[model samples]
Every structure is written in C-alpha cells, then in structure tokens.
Target: MVPHVLGSGPTAPPMSTPVDRARRGKEARKRLPRSEHARWLPSVDRADPVGVLERQGRDRLPELLPIRYGRMAASPFAFLRGAAAVLAADLATSPHSGLTVQLCGDAHLLNFGLYASPERTLLFDLNDFDETFPGPFEWDVKRLAASVAVAARENSHSENDVRRSALAATTAYRTQMRRLAGMGELAVWYERIDAERLLPFARTARGRRQVESTLARARRRTSLQALGKLTEVVDGRRRIIHDPPLLEPAGAADAASLRKIFSDYRSTLSEERRLLLDRYRFVDAARKVVGVGSVGTRCFIVLLTGRDANDPLFLQIKEARKSVLEEHLPSGPYVHPGRRVVVGQRLMQAAGDIFLGWMTGPQGRAYYWRQLRDMKGSAEVAAMGPRQLRRYAELCGTALARAHARSGDRIAVAAYLGGADTFDRAVTDFALAYADQTATDHAALCAAVAAGVLRAAPDV
Candidate 1:
C-alpha cells in the first residue's frame, strides 16, 4: 500500500526588506564567487557512465532496456538527454549557489516546449518533471546551458558559435531573474510566455515561418487528433492500433490491472476533475514506449469514450521512480514518487493538465496519469542555425528563470548574479566542458554495446 504521508505546502520566504535580501545574495557571492562556476574537470574516480545507466535500468522493464540504449546511443545530445543521473552526479561534485527551487531536474532543451494552458491557449514552459526536486537553482541552469552547447556542437556550429549559444542561455536567465526580482509577488507568479510572444524572437522570415508552423501543429495535437491516428474501429468498437514495440496491445492481465487501478487514480483528482473523468468510460489500453530516458519504464495509454464513440480521451499511466536528483540532494516532502512528480509539475508549470493525478499500482509501483496528447509540441533543435539556436536558447533561459522565480528566492539569486555577465560567462565555460564529457560518455556507451556489455536494439 502507498504510505499515507501528508506533504508540506509551499512556504513563503521569510519576511525581510529588499536590502536584507540583497545583502543575503551578496554574502552568497562571497562564500562561492560567481566566477568559480567556470571550472569542470572529471574526477579520476568518476563512476563509469555506462555503469550508471545500467544501474538505472535495473528496475525498469528488462526487455525495453535495449531500446533505451539504442535511443541514447544516437548522438552526444541524445545521450545527454537520457543521462540525467550522470549529470546530477557531476553537478553534485561542484559547489552551487545554494538558491533552492523546484528544479525541472532534467531541464534539457527538448524538455521545454509548447503545451495548451487550461484556457486552451498555447504556452511554452517546462513540460517534463520526472526529475523535479528542490535543489540549488543553478543545477537546472547548468543543465539547460549544457544542452545548448551540446546541440550547437551537434549542428556543427563553430566553436565560438557554440560558446555564444551557451552564453545566451545564461545571460537571458540572469537578466530575466533580475527583472523578476523587481516585480510584485503576484506579478512574478502570473508571468508566462504565450506562444504568440515567441514570434518576436525569430530574427528572419524563415525563422518566423518555422515558429508559426510549430504553433499550428501544437494547436492541432489535441485528443481528437490522436483518435484518428492511434485508434481504429473493430467490429463497431474503438480500439487502439498496434505498432509493434513502440505501441502494442496490452495483454489480458496487464489490461485487467490497469482497469482495477482506474478508481484509485480517480480518487487523487479534485472533485470537479473526478466528475469530468467519470464521464469517460474505459475502452481499451496499450503498452507504449515514450522518450529517451523513459523508454524502459512501464507506460500504458488508455482509451476512453465520453458522450459517444466519436468523443474520446486518452490518458497515459507512466511509472514514476525515485528522482535522479533525490539521492544528490536532501529528502523532498512527498513519500509517493507519483505524487512527487504531480506536485512538482504543478508547482513549476504556469498551467497544468486538469487530468493530472497519481496512484499506486500492483506490486507497489507508483504511476501518474495525464492526457496523452493535449496540444503538445517540441522544437526541432537539429534544424536550427546558429542565429536561430541562440534565440531559442535565450527563450528557454527566460522560461527557466520564470519557473525558478515562482519557487525560489529571486531577489537573492538576482543579487548574486549581480549587474554583470560574470556568472553567465562562467556557466557558459562549464557548459562547453560538460559537452566534451558527454561526447566521451556517449562513446563509452557505444563501446559497451560493441563489447557485448550491453544490448542495444536498432533505433526505432
């Protein structure tokens, strides 16, 4: 049974004058100079990256491990996307700003994207929270900066352009944080980046057109659209289509387990949401593969009908394990892993899915439920040129700062960053260094596959 533990609510920062907050920030700078962040050298005893991945995969579905390795082995950037635990360990070795916030623990570029708000408006913000936990805000910043560096290098940007892209991310983060520090509490809480606001960041006509296309695609990615693509009529009954390892029909036992847990998940939702969910009757389910890091986890997509066969809703039930950052940082509030993810996501996102909820399934595994497709769209980083990459990096940085401002001490963080680009440059340097480490790590993974130390299914 899942433990009945009461989670703590968000606490406001202690009452203090702006002068005191600024002083606190300055003091932190003295303790750990902003320039000190520029350093990054792997320890001689650093754990093998492949071994770390093997440890993470032990608790996952064994058959799916090959697919996880295959997806991560595709590129250095892809490896970084799947190796959040490796990055967490590396970040833990260095001293941090000590500014606590609910981190998007795996805040890579692909994790930030377009999703529909409760009001059906498209908003860009952090969309993944599998690793979300309260930790030094700099951890997420470094991850974002490092992702930009890795992606720029993958696109064959010049060394200077790569560094410039990383710098743009940190620079925008520092500047936006400072701006948020000067805002009223409610104003900072309400701040968001609407999809329309993204147009101004596009420097050229082509860039603008690309942004428009992405937005249009996101708007079309509702549950209704997924019905046509993922479902078919079998003897007048709607059923999920099979697509082999990526998407396949759930077995009789697995389907029964899913149906049994449906009520338990419904209990976690608010009264209104529960009523909304009750309107949809269960139809079918399928085992599915998802993202790079999450591929091996037990994930299932359930089909439900609302008013009629034409009206459908798809909810995804994904396993939630202990966060990668959990061991590196102090203990968090929630005991149930699924609740931790749901709560962390709610705290960090400007708006979240109404169907978000959690439940403990068979054998005490934790799972969270949410819409499978709700106007979600991600960026195509590989296609971006240097100019477009830098702009996108800046946009991501701004969104990161906004998320941090909601959960961390913006005044102190802004003050520590100061009115200069020192911190920005330091993190940028760290990003380049980490990008090199990631390349070496990716090679190690490939070598492991070649030596028969690990199995890697061909990329799907």
Candidate 2:
C-alpha cells in the first residue's frame, strides 16, 4: 500500500496573512472539537501490543530479543518508550486537527536531551528519531503528554502531580507556538533552545545544579574519553574490548565489508563534510547493543584514528528499519530506510551531527552513521521530584514546538490551539487515561514472560 504524503501537491493556503491563517486554524477546531481528545478507551478489536512487538522482533537479532522484552517489562514507562508501533496503531484512530508535520514519532519525555552543536555549545532538543515520519502534529504531543503521566505514576507521584505536569506541557506548547507564529518565517526557522535560554526553566537550586552537572558531564564525553574506556592496547595496537552479548567483535566477513560501507557513506555527506571526514581512517568495528528499543537491531561501532594514535573518532552505524508510523501515516518519498531517518532528522533537529550519513549494508539493509558520543545526555527522569518533572515537561513542550514550527505551518497551529485551556485540559485527561492503559499492558507483558510465552533477560 502506498502511503500518501501529508500536505502534498500544490494547495492554496487557508489564508494569505498570518493572522488570517491562524484564524482559519482556529475555525478548524469546530469540526475536530478539543473534547474529542478526551476519548482514550481502546477499541474492542484494537491491535494486541505484544503481538506487534513480537512481529517487529522478527527483523532483529535473535539473541538480543530477550533483552528488549526485559527492558520493556521493567516498568510501564519503559514499555511506552519501546512501543512506538503500538501507540502509532492506537493513535491513528484518534481525533486530529487535520494538520500534519514531521513527527518525532516516539516523543516520550526521556527522548528530549542535551547534545552539542557544531560550536561545542549545549543545545537541548529531541535526541531520538528512529520512528520519525510525517504525521499529525497531535500524535507527537499526545505521546509526550501520556509519557509524563506514566512516568509520574512510576515515580509514585500523586494524581494531582501527573495532571499538573501534563497540563503544563500542553500549555507551554500552545504558548510557544503562538509566540513563534508571530515571528517572521526565517526567524521561526532559526529559533532553538540552548542552555542559555533554558536557565529560567530551572525552578529550584537543586534543579539548577542538575542542569549544570548534566552539561558538565555532556561536554566531557568526547571521542577520546570513549576510546580510553571502550578500547585497550593489545600487543601494541588499540582494539575494542569484547563483552559478549553487549559488545562482540564483528564476523570476519562483516569487518572486511565495512571499509566499502564507510566509503559509500562518506559520499552521502556534503563536499565540506566529506573533506572534513577524509582526515580519519577506519580501523576496527564491533557489533554493539544499544538502547532498549534498539537492542535487537544490528548496531556497530566503528573505530577510526586521525593523524596520530592519540586522535580518535567513533562512529555508530545503526540499522534503520521502516518507521513504526509508516503503516498508519503517509511515508515520505525515500526508497531507503536510512535516507528516511537521515532526511527526517535533518528536518526536525535544530543542529544535526556533522558526521551524519547513510548507506546500505551487505544484506541490502539500510543504516545511518553518526558520531557515537557527542556531548549527549538525558535527564534522570526516574530520580526527578514532582517540581522538577513539571519544569522538564515545560522544557519538552517548548522544544517540540520549536521543532514543529520549523516543519509545519506555525501560524495555523497557533490558531488551532488559541488562547484557551480547552485543548490542554482535554490532553491532560487523555494522558491520565492512557497511563492507566499502559499499567494494564505492562501487567500483561509480565504475565507473558511468567507463562513462558515470551523470554526476558532482566538486569542486563
């Protein structure tokens, strides 16, 4: 089935002026009432969550499948983090404003983090885009809001805290969108959330310390630091260590073909980036397991050195599969899955990785490559207090708004959201309700593992 691209072909704008566009957007709310968002009950024949996961596992490494299940089985929040496909199926049937944008697809709270820009400054934005695709703007927002409630529950916060944090997120999104809509097109495109702009959001002394500490830690995670920790001198040559199941040496054939893959990947970059990358020479590669959702997928870390032995670079080549949203939404015009991820990320991120590139593997599988660790850090959501969580939620909303404004019609979205609490309240209600569903689904996952229907390797 061919997926139709959102906002495709030449179509007249709803209005000429920004104010008129916003007004038209507000008018759209009549057909798709904000209250429609309050409906969160799954349909009688909704797709089974476990079945979707098991089907996805077919395309991944057999040995690491148990680890993926174990991670999700840890908590409801963990399950939500890895189950973008499950939520995509369910959200496809939900009410939308008919407005579309490049979605984060899995815009949970943990996905927002601090990463370095080319200037070495810490910029806060959405860090994961494995499931990124063109979809209704609300889907990303809903997923983010629902995650707040789920995380709140996991942290043992009161019901009021959950509702408050969720509401704060939507409110911040709406407010920021309205502000961005008032700016010029180029101005909106250039807007970003860096550390300097993020200081006001830290509400307490502890929060301030957390921010400073996270930034300090991110700046220190350079390739040199990774080289020292992940590799060792063996017989006078630096080699990656083998820690079975987590980090194992690639097969002889896979290692031999990596040089060609690296060459093909370099060709995808711009002339300047390619020139910059030419200084480094590929050394060795190892099969490595990564994030919870990406555990079973084929991930390899390639070690490279430049000029001398002290100068090192680490590039992570991760398998890119069809987006979870593809079945439910229009797929972009990209033949290779790696291109889809690369293009989608360029469209969404304020500043992207310099080494970002894509190539097809020996088996014709698509993969994208980027620096393995470049000042990236995520907040400790599990350890956050209620106040910190609410503040973090606000920051996430702001970051998401900036991303959508760059890809979608900001004026129209602002109009659709308007200067009211109706949509905010409805989203809060939906998040709370969905958090309940997540708990129930998590229990079912535990049951599946206990009944021997699924295997799980916990604490890995």
Candidate 3:
C-alpha cells in the first residue's frame, strides 16, 4: 500500500510516473505556501480541543486502558496538557510559503531533556514525537507557547509575565535556528550539552538543582541497572516479569508474530549493528507499556544477556501507525510513515540512537525499534518554575527548527523568516495568544469534569 506524503513535496519520492512527477515537481518548486487549514490549528476552542484529542486518540485505547485520575488531583489546566494535535492541525491549516519538514508535532516546553548518546555524551533534544509528522513551521512553536501559558496559569503567574516568558522562548528558538542553520552539517551534529555547559545558563537555584539531579540520575541509569529492574528469573524460568498495565506475556498468535518481528529486526541492522546483536541472546521478550499518550499502542521490550549473563542490552519495539496529525494530512508521496519518521529523526537531531530501525508487521502494522533504556530518562515537568518553563521552550523551538531544516530548505525558511527579528516577534505573538486559548480550554475541561460531561477519572 502506498503511504501518502502530506506537506512534504520533493523531499519525498516521486509520484510513480514522469508526467505525474513533473507536475508535482513544478508545484513543489514553487514556494509551497502553508495550507489555509494549518494556520487555524492553534486557534481551536479550549473545550473543543479535548474532544479532538479524545477522538484522534480513540483507536488506540482498547489496547491499553488509561490509568484513571482523581478528579481533584489534576490541575484544572492539566486536562489541556497534550492538546498538540488539535493545535498542530490548526497550525497546518494556516499560512506560509517556505520550506516544510517533519516536525516533533508537539514540541512543548516540558519535553526536552538529558539522555545518553551513542558515544555516551549527555545530550538534550525534543524527546517525545508521539504527535510527530509534517506540518507548518509555526505549529510546534505555538503548541510550545500554549503549554507555558497553561503551566504558568497553574503556577499562578500573571498573564503579562507568562506572555513575556513565552516571547523570550520564541526569541531563543528563532535565534538558535538561524545560528545553527549557518553551521556545516557535521559541526551541528557534533554540538551537544552536558551538565558543565548548563551551569552558565541555569540561572535559578531550582533550575540548577533540577539539572544536577537529572545529570546524577542519568549517570546512574546504565544498561546493567536496567537489566535487573526490567527483567528477572521468575520461579526457575528466566522470563520478563508480567506486570499489569506494563508488561504483557502476549497471546500465542501475538507471540508467534512477535518472534518473526524480532527476527526481522536483526536484518534491519548494519554490519556493525548486526555484529553488536551477536554479543547478546534474545532471552525474553514481551509487550510492555510506555508514556502517557502512547499508552494504548503496542510496545514491546526484548531482553538480552551475553557471556556470564552480566552484559546486557535491551531493545524496545513500538507500534507506529498513522499519526493523529495525519487527520489533517492528505496523502502525497511517501508510502511508509514510520520510514518518514526515522529519516526525519536522523536529519533533525544532532545524533540518534545507533540501533534505530523500522519494520512492518504481518498485518502491515508498522513500527520502529531502539534501545529500551540506554540512559533513558526524562525531566519531571511538574517540578519546573516559570523561568525553567521559558528556557525549555527555547530548547524545543531551537530543536524543532533544526529538525525541520534537516529535510526542508533552510535557506528558503531563513529567507521567509527574513534577515531580521520578524519571525521571532511573530512567534511570540502567536505563543501569547495561544497561551490564552489553552488556559480557557483547561478551564472548560475542569468544568466539564465537574459537570460530568466529559469523562476522566477526575484528574488524579
């Protein structure tokens, strides 16, 4: 089956024939204006956003159920927490005629953090791509702004202060993208952040403390330690522990299909990676759960042990389906969305997990796999302050632009962004405005839950 590319033009493969290809090439060569629908994605009503998210996310829930929340525990605004898809779709409908590339879909302030790179460098990046897909440039920026706005309101910041922080974030993103776009690809790839570099930027004691904690935790998060926690010899049988709401042993047919998928994963590797696979035996594999938004999707963890059973490697295979962003994405040229994600990730991030690979299941269900816990960790967003929120936004925006530049024309975007501060200011305006929308939406969710209109286990 052919997977259609959305906004990605020539960056994707041809449309089968020369005449068809020529027609697409001609349209693509022209500055592709942002579709009218992309722009309004950010302007959705707060009440409507929850409905949209629930709808786009409906297909996955039967696979894994939501851990119910206590009505009083979730901050009123928390309900609107991950409304990035609604915002992204609206943003895609908006305006622009510049370079387009794959986006993180939901580049919120809370999603950036420290993790170990292949070479063991502590790196920062846009970590969550659940909402990832191709769309207008501003969609990510606006979602980021709204996150801060909603978070700040929860934290009791004044409206003006929240707006200012959001603007600062917009400024940082625009400035960083322009700066990085000026560098050579290899140089950008070499760039990374560690605890030492953060000292200069972490202004507050809280920020400093948080960074120190994350770095310390990251250092302790080794493959050896994860092996013990995620796996064990159960009752004389060496098996992955079956934890409800987390690990699943799989039905007979599912396990059979999984074995084939696991076997296929080996061939997807390179000579170097294939050699690495020889170092460990696939001891136990099972379907495991992960992440808030990704809960209902199928996720599996494969455990490996080598030599004296001391050496270990873990791989995570996650089902990749049509992104909710695809609701707004009309098919174009690319047939495989998972391939698009892997390719885009390689382009945008400075470095990626060496084990990254894609596969299609017997049912044509697509998925991508990587190391399960190679120094994998994330920041506790609930602990951040307003200042930290702003700075994080800058990181996400900078990273988003860099990722977008990987497959799209950086020069054209830089030109469209103009040789000035126009783009930054425009983003700031959008952020502040959208932040208001997010707050209003959060309130509606709270009221709905109170009135028993929309069901959530009371926001626990």
Expressed as tens digits, the lDDT of each residue in 15-130 for candidate 1 is 99888888888898876799998999988788899999999998899999999999999999999999999999888877776767788999999999999988999999999999
* Candidate 1 Cα RMSD after full superposition onto the native fold (Å): 3.5
How close to the true structure is residue 100 of candidate 2, measured as C-alpha lDDT?
A: 72
Model 3 spans with C-alpha error above 4 angstroms: 1-47, 68-81, 204-207, 330-333, 443-460
lDDT of each: 0.92, 0.86, 0.62
TM-score ranking, high to low: 1, 2, 3
Which is the better candidate, 1 or 3, if ranked by lDDT?
A: 1
Largest TM-score belongs to which candidate? 1
Could you tell me the lDDT of residue 365 within candidate 2?
92
Off by over 4 Å in 2: 1-5, 8-15
Q: Between prediction 2 and prediction 3, which has the larger TM-score?
A: 2
Model 2 deviation from the true structure expressed as Cα RMSD, one decimal place? 2.1
- Using all chains and alpha carbons, the TM-scores for the candidates as numbered come to 0.97, 0.96, 0.82
lDDT of 2 by residue, 1-460 (tens): 2222355311234548876787768876876877777789898888888998899999898999999999999999999998888888888876577777788889999999988998887899999989888777888989999999999888999999989999989889889998998898778777888876666768778778878888888888889999988998889988999898899988888898888788899999999999989999888899999988888999999999999889999999999999998887654667788988898788788999999999999889999999999988888999988888898999999999998888887788888987888888998899999999888888888899999999999988
Model 3, 189: alpha-carbon shift in Å? 4.4
**For residues 239-325, could you state the per-residue lDDT of candidate 3 as single tens digits?**
677777567766668767877777677777788988877777767778886755565677788777878577887788888777666
